[model samples]
Target: MTNNKKRQRVPHHPTSTLYSADTSRSESSLKLCRLTSNSSFNDNSTADVILRLYVDSSSPFVWDSTAEDEVQIYLHSDLLHRSKYFAALLSDRWQNPVSNINGINSDNDKKFIRLNFDVSSPTPSSISDHMTVLQLLYTDDFSSVINSVTVALDLLPVALKLLFEDCVKACVKFIEAVPWTEEEEKRVIEIIPLIREEQSRELLSRLYAPDDSCEEMLNGLIMSAIHNHPNTASVKAFVAKLLREFASRESARRVLERAFEESLKVVKESLEEYSSPDFRGDTCETEAIQRLNLHTAMTNGRHLVWLVERMIELRVADSAVKEWIEQAEFTVNLQRTFRDDAWRNIVPGLPSVVMRCTCKLANGVAGGTILATRQVRMKLVKDWLPVLIVCKDNVSPLVPSQKALYLDLEETFLRIISTLPMSDAQELLQQCLSFSTKNLEDCPHLIRAFNTWFRRATQPSLTGDHC
Candidate 1:
């Protein structure tokens, strides 16, 4: 019973017998060993290294060129060191010798030996054939061989560099998949500066490429962001900028907010597009304002995340809606008060609104007319998005009628006299005009009211600064 317990609890470092490249024959399988000890290790007596060799069938090997396969080792680590069969190394691992072995194409200066043998065998003829391929590595009793990667990198300077992007990506994948410890975390912090900007750009540029493979590069970026120490700041900033510069405003905004809250400049800019609510043409409604309204209204009661997720879930089958979402910016702290009956008044008499522009020079993107056809669609639905936020500074309760809604709206107008955030306030006022423009016929009374007041207020004798 004690022996069984010991066996169960024993920590075993598998012994290995690595195969080496054949000097006489051209074909052979290479092997490696994770050496634990040297004194008693022998290839014939020990079976230590376990392996799951992954190989691509299509990679110049196997029957067809499309499949991949893996071989599992039901053994120990010690067996690795005794194997001597060698093949070309592709990625630190011997490329399946059965396939076209591709070790250092020219660096074969005995880092490996060459073997050119001709044999066509589809499968292992017997168990021994497979076992025979497990060659043992040659070293001066293990203790003499220096396998320290740091020492190797220093001795062979080429080993210290990271050139193949795929290498960085693979390492990053392994890093992200594993949990980081404080010590490991510190190691990453120290490593960031050693990398060059151009090299980083080469990796970052992949994010903008027009292909799905870009996702791999993006993963590398996100993983890098996990270490946000001062050195990582540059990489982090570059990544955020790449997201902003390449992806849609919506996608960029989401990534920005997710990466780091305090560093969401891209998101703020994107939201500005929606917040301005102005698109200069005479489409009757400002695309931005209507968009914010419909979206804000739809998710009015929910948190911002809920609203975003709901949009994703709804997958609203409308082109404009989709575009608005793709392009909408997320800067506002979207937590507005949407009482149950809030939509009842503003929406019933809703104007297909557009924001007017104050630009004297020709404003192209910022100019005249954006179509709010989507807002018109939203108006048909019961949901509402408020374009004008009335921080009703000590005002009477909003009455339930159009008169009350307008009276409160008039308060918004009066605030103009008080000088609000001029840019936003001006933008809001212009949007109100677009709303008025669309519903001109319905608000004739209100329009007429304004006209009458304008005529009286602007008369030559009337000189109050309020005008």
Candidate 2:
């Protein structure tokens, strides 16, 4: 049986309105009162404050008989004073006595406070949120009320507006401890600027990263996927997809190039040690160490092929193409290693693995996936063709798959040679005689290459066509 005839209307403050106007008639029938029976919040006889919550007139919440635009609740000044805003407002009004507070009864001692909100700005949930925070003022166990990110986000701004430090800290702690949805994260970002730097440090740390930290992380992931992970195949595929979808192509390029260079270095050093004249002896220790070196080279050679495919897929293999072309010393060591009979018994797959690395790069160049220059195209074939010839000569009679690998590489090399100058093509094509098979048709790619070379060689010069 609260009396509504004593309530007063108020002038609008920009953030929250506070004013008073006389209203002699009761509007209790039109007003909603959300008065809870909890002793801490609803001791009406002892309560000194009546809070009237309302939406701004311009707000879109349709007010009708069933849904009222405002609600009323009785509160204690001592509990409301826990908020600095209320403490200041109550102290000022008590000392200054401005006509009468919004809903205060002039004939009695009770105070009235009106809080109006634009439902569209903060949110339609704002009224509920403010009421929730005011209820929390009477309780010490904030954890029970502030249980979720949505609850925290809803009440945090209200708490901050009321200058309620404890409730603000509670909301912030809840938000910081939980994971946020992307929409929730955007809300957090929007709220960040409103919070003090010291208070928002942990939240900010989650969103901010140093410039090169991402590149370093990508580099580490690449290495770990290729070298350290026990489940290398699936992990490498996963890492490859990450590189493909990474936002910065340059960063992806730099990370892949670094990994490619490192793998190439290991392969080169392993083969150099294996082919070194010093390790060529048949002694048990030397042969055992040689076997280890060859195995290391073969394993890393597979890694190198994987990296090359990723780089080409990303169109970042230009550097790898150049690096492969410049591997003269490595190729020489490879040829020497293949010429030896020891590796045949120890790692029969080593030659195929090494030549596969060469073939992938050459095919990328030939297919124009990697736009290598004429000199790159020439030296690429010049440097690696001998290794291919040596592998064919020294390895077991090729399995069908291995023979197809060699023939495909031979055709790819000839295609690249066709792009080079006549004399360069002449030297590289002569080496392809080893590519011949008993059935001439089996080697048509080689014949096509030679015929194309001869047609170009015999064509009358465009400059000398006058006669």
Best by TM-score: 2
Residues 1-467 of candidate 2 have per-residue lDDT tens digits of 66442233332221221111211111211122223333345345555566666656555543432223455666666677789988877776655432345543532554444333333333655455666777677666777667778778987998888899889999999999999999999999999998889999999999888899899999999889978999998999899889899999999999889988998999999999987888877799997898899888888888888998898899999999899888889988988888878878777888888778788888888888999888888888988899999999888788988898898899899989899989988988898899998999888998999899989989879876765
C-alpha lDDT values of all predictions: 0.32, 0.77
Residue 257 of model 1: what lDDT?
36
Query: lDDT per residue, candidate 1, 1-467, as tens digits?
Result: 13111111112233433221222111222223333454222222333223333333334434432222333332322233232222112223443222223333212121322222222124322111232232213222221221222211111111113132332333333433454456655544444345456434543342236654455555456546434335655765576556545544454334423432322223334334433435323354664454455444332212222222322332211222323233222302221222223333434222111100001000111111222243332231111123333222212353355334543444324333223333333334343442343556754444644454455555776456667
TM-score of each: 0.21, 0.85
Q: Runs in model 1 with CA error above 4 Å?
A: 1-150, 153-213, 216-242, 245-322, 325-467
Candidate 2: worst-modelled 10 consecutive residues by lDDT: 20-29
How well does candidate 1 score on lDDT at residue 334?
Answer: 26
| Regions of candidate 2 where Cα sits further than 4 Å from its true position | 1-39, 59-68, 94-104, 107-120, 464-467
